[model samples]
Target: MSLRGKIGAGAIALASTPLILFLGTWEGTGQNIVYGDKLARGLPTVCKGLTEHTSPYPLVIGDFWSDARCAEVESLVIRKGQLALADCLTNQQIGQNTFDALSSHAHNVGTSNTCASRAVGLINAGHLAEGCKALAWAPNGTTPVWAYVTDAAGQKHFVPGLHSRRRAEARLCIQ
Candidate 1:
């Protein structure tokens, strides 16, 4: 082989190494869930804030989280949520907007629960709009749900902020 050919081959191999490593890490870590930048940042902050301040939610009374710690937590939460959403879907190849939106929903709703959730069912059934709608209002049958629950008197207490969340999820799903 020519010297130029050898150099070109070496360069290609070197360039491919990072790509290969990144793909491996992404797959192994389940970080392949494509999150739009904005949603990635917004979901965690929204969730954390709601957790800290929302009523009927266990009141967390301290500004204990440093910026870095908060960011770390958010990153972890989003990644886990994305993985959960991806796992729930029989079709993993989805758009970035859908991925971000579902990840946000799952982060709030719990991944395993979301996997078996009405939202996922709707999505898998090809009812995208209805699926997004379900994400907003439907009850997740999976164990370990959030603070929203029913009382002995048969009154239900749903999360107040979830309406907005549903809208957001719907928007992303449609996009």
Candidate 2:
């Protein structure tokens, strides 16, 4: 093969490596984790963070079920045969706006920078891996903040099982 062709092939291989590895090992589907960072966590907003939107949403990024729904149902859990109860929200604001936010994400799972897009964005940016590696406090709470990530398909995902961010960095280098 020509030298140019070889270089191009090599570049392609390198680019695909992470993606191949990621898709094969991505943990942000179905099973989700929660972190301690509050701000970084899922906030009630338009579908996946859209600037212009309509409708209501439910389910925060981290499985924050709505309080009222929880009360009406007399339980924090909600399941509808095939669909597991996924809307668990804290903070009245998050709870109140969840219906809209989740609906919005449910609205666009494959287009734009909606929730799914944010999930992809975070992963591509290495935030998911980085946060997972930086898990602080074992996700048992007490940590300053916690984080959770919903995948491109709106599956619940998290960066839970945290320790100190510094300690996590040390593990990376030592290993």
Candidate 3:
């Protein structure tokens, strides 16, 4: 099925195959183990980036999740993120690629922030390409915004992995 078809079916089915694959590629399937997120130190994350915020229960170090469990949680998380983002999007006619890119961004950042981002505002204003570019850079187009991670001391620093991911997301959005 095409990505659009999958997305339509995802409304009832929870998650689409392509969306799952895209998130898995970025989030990484850390199967059977729970580990602290270096970026958000002390937070236990597992199974494709499920943290206590996204999980039904608290996650601790040494926690384990079977492959099936991981798949289930990942799908749930993706679906939830998609639904939350959908509420913020005024343009219902957006293409599948744009939707996927926005959903992926919402999954990584929070839906609240993604909804309020300049990218979404630009997209709503019908500036599709500019919106895509805004995913990585600020409106000025030079300074990076979403590519940084905040440390416990409240210092934000550039994260290479996040920068690469945002670039990939922008590419997907413009495609």
Candidate achieving the largest TM-score: 3
How accurate locally is residue 151 in candidate 3, as Cα lDDT from 0 to 100?
Answer: 88
lDDT of 2 by residue, 96-149 (tens): 122222222222221233233332233235454333332222333344332344
Q: Say what the RMSD of model 2 is.
A: 17.9
Q: Which sections of candidate 3 miss by over 4 Å? A: 1-14
The better candidate by TM-score, 1 or 3, is: 3
How far out, in Å, is residue 37 in model 1? 27
Tens-digit lDDT string for candidate 1 (1-175): 3222333454212112332233233222323222222222322222243332121323333324444544454455454445445556654334455555665555555667777877778877777766766666544433222335455566666544445555656666667
TM-score of 1: 0.54
C-alpha displacement of 89 in model 3, angstroms?
0.4
| Model 3 C-alpha RMSD to native | 3.4
Over all chains combined, what TM-score does candidate 3 have? Answer: 0.88
Kindly report which residue stretches of model 2 are placed more than 4 angstroms away from their true locations once superposed.
1-18, 23-27, 30-39, 43-175
Error of 1 at 23 (Å): 26
* Alpha carbon lDDT at 84, candidate 2: 17
